[model samples]
Target: MLKIQDLNAFYGKSHVLRGVNMTVERGEVVSLLGRNGVGRSTLCKAVMGLVAPVGHVEFDGKTISGMAPHDIAHAGIGYVPEDRAIFPGLSVLQNLELGMKKKGQTGEKWTLEKVYEWFPRLKEREHTPAEVLSGGEQQMLSMFRALMGDPQCILVDEPTEGLAPKVVADVAAILQQMAKDGLAVLLVEQKLSIALDIADRIYIMGEGEIVFEGTPEDLRNNPEIRKEWLEV
Candidate 1:
């Protein structure tokens, strides 16, 4: 579980996340939705300690605001950036191996075989170099690599951007499955439909602050909120 209170983040003199308050409970999928330049990604970075933040950021009941990124990860949080960071030269298997926390860590839920089972495409391309995979494959690989760490919660930023409709549906299914399996997912996404379909709770951000917090059905029925903040 993750809880953030009065969180603020800055880029030099410019403040990006302005007093953002949100939480992701265990086994829940919480979607953060907003238009561009609204600091959705910055909130993710601040929670991951990738940027300097001022205020409280607690994960599993401990303060993690000033911890190093690696330390934060070691504490059971995984991050999948919008760019889908993967090693171009590394084979799919090798890329997954890099996600391991250590050589002998045990009791983990994710394994190479399980990853192969979950993603047959990854299994087929197990030995192929990452550079040769299609965009959708690369996105799957990114999420798979993060799962390799056996994280309790994952912060995913823009997982469906630039993908075909089928691939987007695949990605959404995987995210939903993750929550069903008891892992918290803080999904930062731009696509309203996808977020509405999969998220249990939704938070809409605008001008770096949360403007709406409600269930997915509540969001869907409220045309004014959709028009004022979400609709393009």
Candidate 2:
């Protein structure tokens, strides 16, 4: 589980992520939705300690706000950035190997074989260089690589950005399966329909703060909140 309270971040004099508060319980999928420039990615970076944070970020009941990124990761949090961030020259299998918490240590919950079973495309391309894979394949690789670390929770940012509809559906299904398997998932997404379909709860952000917190049904019923904070 993850909890963030009064979380704030800054880029020099410009403040982002103003006093944000949220939680992700185990077996839950919580989506953070907002338009561009609203600090959704900044919140992920702050929680991962890539950005300096001014408030509490607790995971499994201990403070992780100031910890180094690697340390935070070792404490059981995974991050999949908007940019996919795979190693271009490395083989697909090699990139996944690098995700292990310790070199050669495949943790209990996730293994290379299990990942292959989950996504056969990855198995087919196991020996191929990562740079040659399609965008959707690359995205799947990114998520599975994080799973190689055996994290208790994952912070996923924009997982379906440029994929085709089918690929987006695949990604959404994988995220839901992750929640069923008991990993707390914090998804920062641009696709409203995907978020609404898979998330147990939703938090809408505007101007760097959470403006709405409710279930997907509540969000569906609130047209005003959608118009003000979410719609383009």
lDDT values, one for every candidate:
0.93, 0.95
Candidate 1 regions exceeding 4 Å error are 104-107
Question: Runs in model 2 with CA error above 4 Å?
Answer: none
TM-score per prediction, in order, is: 0.97, 0.98
Give per-residue lDDT, candidate 2, residue 1: 73
Question: Each candidate: RMSD to true structure?
Answer: 1.1, 0.7
- Taking the tens digit of each residue's C-alpha lDDT, what string does model 1 give over 1-232? 8999999999999989999999999999999999999999999999999998899999999999999999999999999999989999999988888888985442277888778887899999999999999999999999988888999999999999999999999999999988988899999999999999999999999999999999999998999999999888
Worst 10 residues of 2 by lDDT: 101-110
Number of clashing pairs per prediction, in order? 0, 0
- Expressed as tens digits, the lDDT of each residue in 61-147 for candidate 2 is 999999999999999999999999999999999999999988888868889998899899999999999999999999999999999
Among all candidates shown, the one with the greatest TM-score: 2
TM-score, predicted candidate 2 vs. hidden true structure: 0.98
Cα error, candidate 2, residue 86 (Å)? 0.6
TM-score result, candidate 1 = 0.97
